[model samples]
Target chain A: MSESDLEEMFTLAVSVAKEAGQIIRDAFDKEKEVDTKLSAADLVTESDQAVEKIVNTRIMEKFPTHRFIGEETTSESGEKHELTDDPTWIIDPIDGTTNFVNRIQEVSFSLGIMVNKKTVIGVVYAPIKDEMFTARLGKGAYLNGMKLQASKITDLKQAVIITEGGSSRDAKEVEDKVKNIHALITHTRGIRAYGSAAVNLCHVAAGRGQGYVEYGIHIWDFIAGALIAKEAGAVVLDPTGCDLDPLRRRILCACSPEVAKGLSQILTHLDMGCD
Target chain B: MSESDLEEMFTLAVSVAKEAGQIIRDAFDKEKEVDTKLSAADLVTESDQAVEKIVNTRIMEKFPTHRFIGEETTSESGEKHELTDDPTWIIDPIDGTTNFVNRIQEVSFSLGIMVNKKTVIGVVYAPIKDEMFTARLGKGAYLNGMKLQASKITDLKQAVIITEGGSSRDAKEVEDKVKNIHALITHTRGIRAYGSAAVNLCHVAAGRGQGYVEYGIHIWDFIAGALIAKEAGAVVLDPTGCDLDPLRRRILCACSPEVAKGLSQILTHLDMGCD
Candidate 1:
C-alpha cells in the first residue's frame, strides 16, 4: 500500500477503534454477564460481542468490498481465511476480553490491514490508558503521536520480557507454555505477563518492555501490534521460526532484533513447541 | 499503629518514594554502568545505588534513629538482616532493576514502614508512569489520591492474574512455578507478567488485575506493595498459605481474600511445591 493509503487506513482504524472502545467501556461499566467458551478459563462477555458488533458495523459501512475477519464472529467457524491478494481487515474489538469483563482496564481495540498477504497497516489503541499505537509498512510506528523505537538492550541479562501461555485447559498445552517459561527464566532479566497480547506488543514497541512472547494467539490479537513493533525497529517473529499463519496463528515474539534472535535460538535449542 | 500515626508515616513514605524515584529517574536519563550479582539476570545499576543513598539520607535525617533495611547497601554485604522494631523502614530503592537497566520503564521506588516489626505504612512510586500507590495501617490504599480496592472476582475462571517465575535454570524450581501456572491457567481468565512486584501488587490493589503471584523475590520487592494490597482488602499470602514473610520472602500471591483462597486451593489440589 502507498503511504497515503496507509495513512487513510490508519486514520479509519483509529476512528473505528475509538468507537469500539466507547462501546466496550459502556458495557464494562454496566454489570456484565460473563460466560465461558469451551472452559471456564476461556471467558467471553456481552461487552466483547457488543464492541465487536460496533467495529464490524463501522468497517462494513466504510468499506463494503474489504474482507473482514473478527474473533467473535469468524473464529467459531474454525475455517482458515487468507489475507492475500487484497486489502483484508482484521479486527479484535476487545483483545483482552478478560480484562474488559473484569473491568481491569487494560483491554484494547486491535485492527490490522493486510495487503498481498502481509500486514501493511495497523493500529492498536488502549483508550482507557489513552495510548494509541499505529504503524504502516515502511512508514515507521508511532505511540500516542510520538515515533516509537525499541530499546538498545543487547544482552539477554539486561532485557525485560513479557510472556504468557495459552488459556487452554489441556494439560499438555499448558505444559508446552511452561517449557518455554523454563527456557527463558534464567536467560533474561525478568519476565512480565501483562495479560494482553496487543498491549504487551505495544509496550515492546514503546520500549516499556524489551520483548513479548505468547503461545496460541489469534492474528487479530497480534497483527496490529506486531506491525507497530516491527516498524518501531523491533523484530517480530514466530517463536517456531516459521512464517506466522495469520489464520491459524499461535506463538510469537516481538523484540529488538538482538533479543529476538537470542530468544528464538534458546526456544529452538530447548525444542519448545510453538505451533 | 494508630490511624493518625499511620497517616503521618504514609506521608513520609510517599515523600521518600518520590524523592527516591527522582534520583532513579535522573540516573536513568544519564549514563548507566550496570553490575551483576547472582547472575546477569540480577542487575544493580548506578541508579539503584543513587536512589538508595538519597532515600537513606532523607529517612535517617527525618526520623533520626529509625532502622532501615535496603536492597543496595545491605544486600551488597551479603548479610541478611531481619526486620526490626523501633520503627523499621524497608526500602527497595529501585525494584525491577532489570527493567531500569534495560530502559523498560516499569521500575519503581518502594518504601514500607514497620512498627513493632509489622508493616504499617507503604508507598510505591513509578515516576515514568507517574503512578503513586500508598497505604497505612487501617487507612486503606490509594493510587494517585484515588481510593484503591481489589476486584470482586469470585470465580477463578473469571480472574485475570499476573505472575513471574525466577530463573528457570533450576528444573525443580521451574517445575514448581509451572505447577502453579498449570493450575492457574485452567481456572483464571488469563495470566499476566508485568515484571515489577510493586507495580503488580499495586495493580491488584487498584483492581487492574485480580491477583499477582511471583516466585523468588525479596522482601524489598514486595513489602510495601503487599502491605498496600492488604490495606486495600486484598489477601497477601505466601504460596504455602502462610502469612507473607517479613524477611527474605519468596513465592507470594496477592489478591482478594476469596480469590486467594480459591487459588491457594487449586495450587494445593494440583500438589504444587508451595503447599
Candidate 2:
C-alpha cells in the first residue's frame, strides 16, 4: 500500500473507532443484553454486535475491495480467518465486552490494518476513559495525541506485569494460567489485571506497566494494540520469546527485551493452539 | 462526636486529600526515589512520605485533639496502631505506592475519620485519574459528586471479583494467596487487579466489579474504602464471613450478601494477623 493509501485507511480507522467508542460510552451505564459464548466468562453484549456491524459496514463501503476480519464475524461463521497479501482490516469492535457488561471502565474498540501479512496501522479507543491510542508502522504511537513511550525499566524485579484470567474454563488451561500468575507475582514487583487484552497492551505502551502477557486471545483482541505497543518502542513476542504469531492465541509484550526474556523464562507458557 | 464535628472533620479530610493529590500528581510522571519495605514488591517512594507528612501536619493543625494513624508513620515507627473510642483519623497518603512509582493510575490518597471507634467519614482521591470518592456514615457514597451504588449481582458465577497480588513476598503467603486466586477464577465470571486496596474497594462501591477481597492490608489501606463500599450498599466483612475487624489485615467486600457468602465459602482464607 502507498503512503497515501495507508493514510486514508488510518483516517477511516480513527473515525470508525470514535463512532464505536460513542456507542460504547452511551451504553456503558445502561442495562445490557449480554450473552455468553464458549464459557460464562466469555461475554458478548448488544453494543458489541451493533458496533461491529456498523464498523464492518463502514469499512466495506469505503474500501470495497479490502478484506475484513472481525471478532463477531469470525464467531458467527465459526471458521478460521485466512490471511492474505491483500490489505486486510481486523477489528475487535468491543475488546473488553465483559468489562462493558459489568460496567467496568476498561472497554475499548481495537482495529488493525495489515498488508502483506504485516500490520501497518493500529487504533484502540477506550470510550469510558476517553483514551484513543493510535499508531502507524514507522511513526510513534500516540495516546490522545501525546506521544507514548514504554518504560525504561529492564529488570524483571523492577517490573509490574499486566495479565489476565481469560474466559477459558478448561481446568488444565486455568491451572496453567494460574501457575503463570504465581510466577509473575513471585518474580516481579507486582502484577495487575485490567481485564482487557487490548488495554493491557496499551498500558505497556503508555508505560503504565512494564509488560503484559496473556494466553487464549484471538487475533483481533491484540492485533491493534500489539502494533501500538511496538510503535511506542516496546517488544511484542510470543510467550516463548519468538516473534508474535497473530493467529496464535497468546502474546508477551514488554517495555524492553530483557524483561520480555525474563518473563518468558518464568511463565508456564500455555500452548493454547492457533486461531 | 456530634454531627457538626463529623461534618467539619469531613471537610478537612476532603481538603487534605486534594492537597495530597496535588503532591501525588506533580510527582507521578517524574523520576521517583523508590524504597522497599517488606520485600522487593513492597515499594515506598518519596512521594509517599512527603504526602503522609503533609497530610498529617494538616490534620493535626485542624484537629489537634484527634489521634492520627497513617501508613508511612506506622512503617517508620514500626509500631501497631491502637484503635480507640476517641476521634481518630487514618490515612494512606499514597494508597498504591508501587503504582505511583511505576506511573500506574491506581494510586490514591485515602482518609477516614472514626469517632467512638466507628467510621463517620471516608474519602479517596485518585489524583492521576481525578476520581474523588467520598462517603459519610448513614449517607450514600459519591464519585465526583455523582451518587454511587454497588452492583446487584448475587451469584458468584455471575460476578466479577477484584483482588491483588499484594506486596508480600513470603513464600507461604504467596502460595496461599495464589490458591485463593485459583478459587476465585474458578468460581467468578472474572477477576481484576488494579494494584490499589483503596481503589479496589471503591471499584466495588462504584459497580466496576461485583466483589473485592484481599489479605495482609492495614487499617490505613482500607479504612476509607471500607466505609465507601458500605455506604454504597455493599457488604464489608472478614474473608471468613465475620464482621470486618478493622485491624485484622484482611477484608472481603461484595455488592450483595449472597455473593459475599458465596465468595467466603470458596476462598481459602488466610489468617493474616492483626495490624
Candidate 3:
C-alpha cells in the first residue's frame, strides 16, 4: 500500500476508535447489569455489546467492501474464522472489559486495517485518559500527538516486560502461561500485566516498557498494537522467537532489535516451553 | 486524634502533596540534571530535593514539635534515623524516582503520619493523574472522592496480586522474590507491577486487585498505604505473616482476612526466604 493509502486508513481507524470510545464513556458510571460467562472473574455487560455494535456498524456502513472481524460477533458466530485477503478491519470495541466492568478506567478501543493479510495501519484510543496511539506501516508511532519510540535499554536484565497470565477460555493454558512466567522472571528485568493487550503494546511502542508476551489474546486484542509496535521500530514475534503471523494472536514484542535478541537468549536459557 | 484533628491533618497533607506535585510536574518534561548515586538508575535530582524542602518546611512551620523524615534530607544529613514516640511525619518526595526520572508517569508524593510510632493518618497523591488517596486510622479509605475497599475475591486462584522486583542494592533478595513469585504464579490468578508502591497499594484500596507485596520499602512507602489498606478493611503484614511493625518498611498486604490467610499460608508453604 502507498503512504497515502496507509494515511487514509489511519484517519478512519482513529475516527472509529473515538466513536467506540464515546460509546464506552457513555456507559461508564451507570448501574451495570452484569452477566458472567465463565465465572465471576470473567464477565460481560450490556455496555460491552453496545460498544461493539456501535463500532462494527460505523465501520461497515462507511466501508461496506471492507471485511470485518470483532470480538463480540465472533463469540456469537463461532470460531475457526479467518480474515480475508481483501482490506479487513479488525476491531476490539472495549479492550480490558474487566477493568471497564469494575470501573477501573483502563479500557480502550483498538482498530487495525489489514491489506493482503498484513496489518498496515492501527489506532488505539483510551477515552478515560484522553490518550490516542496511532501508526501507519512506515510512519512512526505517536501517543497523544507526540512522536513515540521504544526504549534504548537493550539488556534483558534492565528491561520491563508485560505478560498476561491466561485467557478465560483456557484455564490449563493460563496455568502453563504462569509457569513460563516463573521461568522468565528470574532472567528478565521486571513483569507487569495491565489487563489490556492494546494498551500494553502501545506502552511498548512508546518506550514505557521494553517488551510484552501473552499466551492467548484474540486477534482484535493485538492486530492494531502489533502494527503500531512494528511501525515504531520494535520486533514483533512469538514467544518462541519467530516472526509474528498477523492472522495469529499469541505474541512476543520487544522494544528494539538487541533487546529482542537478549530476550530470546534468556528464554532459551530458562528452558521455557514456548512455541 | 479526634475527627476534626484527623481532618486537619488530611487537609494539610493534601495541600503539601499538591505543592510538591507541582514542583515534580514542572520538572517532568525538562532536561533532568540527574545525580546518579551508584548507577544511572539510582538517581536523584534538584527537583526531588526542592519538593522535599517545600514539604518539610510546610510541616515544620505549622507544627514545630512534630518530626519530619524525607528521602532527600535523610540521605543528605546522614543522620541516625529513629521513629520517636511523639508524632512523626514520613515523606517520600517521589516514591518511584526511577519512574519519575524515566518519564513513566507512575510516580507520586507519599505523606504519612505516625502518632506514637503508629500510622494514624496517611495521604498519597499522584499529581500526574490528579488522584488523591487518603485514610485515617478509623475514618476509612478513599480515592479521589469515592470511598474505597479492597477486592472481595476470596479464592487465591481468582486473585490478582501486585509485587515488585527489588533494586540492585538487594540483588539476592530480588532473586529470592522472583523465586517466591514463581511459586505464586502457579497457584494464583494474575500478577502485576506498576513501578510505584503507593499506586499499587491505592489500587488494592480501590478493589482493583486482591493484594500487593514488596521487600525493603521504607516507612514512607508503606506507612501511608498500610493505614489506607487497613482502613479499607484489608489486612497488612510482614512476610513472616505477623502484623507489620508500623515503623518498619517491608510489607505484605491482602484484600480480605481469608485471602490474607491464604497468602500467608502460601508464603509459608513455599519457604520464601524473607526476614
Candidate 4:
C-alpha cells in the first residue's frame, strides 16, 4: 500500500475506534449482564457483542473487501485465526471485558489493520480517559495527538513493569505466572496489572510505564497496542527474543532495548508454558 | 466531637484534599527528580514533599491544635506514629509516588482525620481521573459527590481482587506474595495491581472491584482509603481478621461480609510473613 493509503487507513481506524469507544462509555453506566466463555472467569457481556458488531460493520462498510477479525466473535468457536497476506482489520471492541463488566474505568477499544502480513495502522482509544493512541508503520506514535516517547530507563531495577494473570485459571498456569512475578518483582521497581493489554501497552508507549509482558493473550488483544508501542520506540517481541508472530500468544514489550533484553533473559530462564 | 463537627471536618478534609490534588496535578507535567527512602524501589519526588507541605499547612491552618502525621516527614525519622485520642490528620499527599514520578495517572492525594482514636473523616483525590472519594463516620462514602456502594459478590470465583507487591524484595517475602497470588488467582475472577493502595481501595468501594489485599503498607497509605471503603459497606481488616490497627502493616478489604469471611479464611491458611 502507498503511504497515503496507510495514512488514510490510520485515520479511519481512529474514527471507528472512537465511535466504538462511545458505545462502550454509553453502556458503562447501565447494569452489566455477564456471560461465560471458556471458563467461569473468562467473561463476555452484551456490551462486548454490541460494540463488536458496530465496529465490524463500520470497518466493512469502509473497506468491504477487507477481512475482519474481532475478539467477541472469533473466540466463541475456540479457534485461533491467522492473518493473511491480504489486508485485514483486527478489532478488540472492548478490551478488558472483565474490567468493563466490573464497572472499572480501565477498559478500551482497540483496532488495527494488517497488510501484507504486517501491521500498518493501529488505534487504541480509551474513552474514560478520553485518550486516543494512534500510530502508523513509519509514522511515530501519538497519544491524543501529542507525540509519545517511551521511557529511557535502561536498568531493570528502575523499571516499572506491567503484566496480567490472564483469563486462564488452570492451577499450573497460575503457579507459573506467580513464579514469574516473583522473579521480576525483586529486580524491578514495581509491577502493575491493569487487566487490559491494550491500555497497558499504550501506557508503556506514553512512558508512563517501562515494560509489559504477558502470555496466553490473543492477537486481537495486543496487535494495535504493539504497533503503538513499537512506533513509540519500544522493543516489541516474543519472549524468545524474536519478532512477534501474529498467531503467537506471548508478548514482551519494553521501553528500551536494554530493558527488553533484561526481561527476555528473565522470561527465558523461567520457561513458562504457553497457553 | 459532635456529628456536625465531624461533618464540618469532612467538608474541610475534602477541600484540602482537592487543593493538595491541584498541587500534585500542577507539578505532574514538569520534570520529576526522584529520591529513595526506605529502599531504591520506594521512591519520593519533589512533588510529594511539596504537596504534603500544602496539605499540612492548609489543615493546620484550619485546626491549629490538631496533630499531624505525614508519610514523608514521619517515615523519614523511622517512627511509627500512632493514632492517639487527639484530633490527628494522617496525610499521604501523593499516595502513588512512583506512579507520579513515572507520569502514570493512577496517583492520588489521601488524607484522613482521626478523632478520639477513630477515623472521623477521609478523602482521596485522584486528579488525573478527576475523581474524589470522601467519607465521614456514621455517614457514607461518596465518589465525585455520588454515593458509592461496594459490590455484592460473595463467591470467590466471581470476585476481582486487588493487591500490591510491596517495597521489600526479600526472597521470603517475594515467595510468600507469589504464593498468595497463586492461591487467589485460582479462585478470583481476576487479579489487579494498580500500585496505589489508595486508588485500589476506592475502586473496591465503588464496586469496580470486590476485594483488596496487601502487606507491609503504612497507615498513611491506607487510612483514608480504609474509611472510604468501610463507609461504602466493605469490611476492612488485617490478615488476622481483626480491625485494622493504624500501625499494622497488613490489609485485606472485601466488599461484602461473606467475601471478607472467605478471604480471611484463605489468608489465614497461607499465613504470609509480615514485613
RMSD (Å) of each candidate, 1 decimal? 3.2, 0.7, 4.0, 2.2
User: Each prediction's TM-score against the native?
Assistant: 0.92, 0.99, 0.85, 0.95
Model 2 DockQ (Cα-based): 0.91
Q: Stretches of candidate 4 above 4 Å error?
A: A268-275, B268-275
Write model 2 residue lDDT over A137-216, tens digit each, in one string.
98999999999999999999999999998898889999999999999999999999998999999999999999999999
lDDT of 4 by residue, A1-275 (tens): 78777777777888888888888999987888988987788999888899899888877888898899888888776665756888989989899988887777789999988999899888999997788999988889999999999998899888999988888877777777887788778879889998899999999999988999998888888999999999999999987788887677889999998999999887633343332
* TM-score of chain B in each prediction: 0.90, 0.99, 0.92, 0.94
Stretches > 4 Å off in candidate 2:
none
lDDT of 1 at B57: 88
Please give, for residues B1-275, the per-residue lDDT of candidate 4 as tens digits. 87777777777888888888888889887888889886888899888888888878887788899899998888677765656799999989899888888778899999988888898888999998899999987789999989999988788888889988777777777777887777778778889988899999999999988999988788888999999999999999886687776776788999987887777777633343332
Worst lDDT run of 10 residues, candidate 2 chain A, spans: A73-82
Q: How far is B44's C-alpha from truth in model 3 (Å)?
A: 4.5
CAPRI tier for the interface of model 4: medium
lDDT of 3 at A261: 73
lDDT measured at residue B55 in model 4 versus the true structure, 0 to 100 = 78
Q: Rank the candidates by lDDT, best first.
A: 2, 4, 1, 3
Q: How close is candidate 4 at the interface, in terms of C-alpha RMSD after superposing the true interface residues?
A: 1.0
Model 2: per-residue Cα lDDT over B1-275, one tens digit each: 67788888888998999999999999999998888998988989888899989888888898899899989889989887789998999999899889999999999999998988899999999999999999999999999999999999998898999999899999999999999889999999999999999999999999998999999999999999999999999999999999999999999999999999999999988989888
Better of 3 and 4 by lDDT: 4
Q: Write the per-residue lDDT of candidate 1 for residues B1-275, one digit (tens) a residue.
A: 56776566667778888788777777775558988776657778877888888888887877787898888887678776765668888888888777777676777899888888788888999887889998877889999999988877776666788877653345566667777776777677778776678988998898877878777777788889988898887888876677766554554555656777777777732222210
Model 3 steric clash pairs: none
